[model samples]
Target: MNLQAVKILFLKDLFLSRRQLFAYFAAGLASSALTTIPNPTVSFVGFLLMITVAIASGIHLIGTLMLSESTDQTRLFVMSMPISLLDYSVGKIAVILTTYLIPWSAMFASSAILTFVLPTSKHGSFAVLPAIFLFLLCAFLIQLVTAVVSESVGWTISVMVGCNVGLNVFFMQLFASPEISAAAKSDSVSWPPVLIQLLTVELLIAAGALVTAFIAQTRKRDLV
Candidate 1:
């Protein structure tokens, strides 16, 4: 594996995503500010906005970054370089994960903190935010794999739509579970085994999808 090539590819991807990165940061800051508002209704709106912004940012950034090579007709230029398919895959994965995770984690943490401070009667539902985030991450990974493997704009969009809809289903199922709902009622951080197991599965699936995508790329003899 060419470490230098991987680094170059990663840096190039990051550079291309710099503008989206700025918008993500702005969204985070705006959401954070809204959370600080004293009114309960306004604060709740802020929380919802934060969730929306985080999900949208992840989708937009990853979608654009993954499709950029093909959309811009730069795949041939990139393929002509010293980079291998594995290296390129690893670089793109690293770039997208780093760009998406940091903001998502921050937003999740803030929501968790907010849940801890608010009354259980009103804010109990918010406690499941982290688990919901794990599901979102899983959904995002599906789109990532679609982007990496098919590289078809239409298929990628379909996967995104399906994942978005699936998110609601997963959220409802998880939140409705007695164990998870009970965990959400706690005043402190709760990491019940059930939730932990669920997260582990999501993480594993994401890792597997990434590996599969890398292998698929490596086997391709006719990449443009």
Candidate 2:
């Protein structure tokens, strides 16, 4: 791998993404403000707002950093540079993932803090927000891998739709399950065996998809 070239490409993407980065932080701050309201119903709405911000920011960044590269002119410009395709792949993935994680982590930490501060009688169920964040991150990873590998707008859109629908259904099922609901309400954080197993599977899928994408990039003959 061309480490120097990778660094240059990464810096290029990072520089170009600065505007989107600022917007993401602004959205995160707005969501945090909403969550800080003392009303339980309002806070719940705010939490939903936070989720929307996170997902939208992720999609926007993916489009800017990954999907745009698939266009003919952009592909030609990038390929004309000194970097190999592998360097481009590593740089784009690293830059996009790192950029996304910044806002995601900030929003997640704010949500966790808000959940903990919420009154037990009103919003104690917010404890499950962390688990929900994990699920969301898994979905983001799947979308990222799909964009990087397939380079097809249709596949990416389909994955986004499936993830959004599936995540809502999964959370609803989790809330409905007696054991999981009980765990969510406990005085302390509880990682029930089932929750642990589910999270493990998600992490595995995400990791596998990322590794597979890198492998595919290495073998790819056409940069365009």
**Root-mean-square deviation of every model:** 2.5, 2.0
Query: Pairs clashing in candidate 1?
Result: none
Over 4 Å off in model 1, which ranges? 36-38, 116-127
Q: Using Cα atoms with residue i matched to residue i, what is each candidate's TM-score against the true structure?
A: 0.87, 0.92
lDDT tens digits by residue: candidate 2, 104-164:
8889887777657756432445556656877888888889888988888889989999999
Judge candidate 1 at residue 49 and give its lDDT.
Answer: 84
Name every residue pair that clashes in candidate 2: none
Q: What is the lDDT of residue 54 in candidate 2?
A: 81
lDDT, candidate 1, 14-103, per-residue tens: 898888887887787779668767787887798778768767987887667878779888887888888777787788888888888867
Backbone clash pairs in model 2 (N, Cα, C under 3 Å; residues 3+ apart or in different chains), count? 0
lDDT of each: 0.77, 0.82
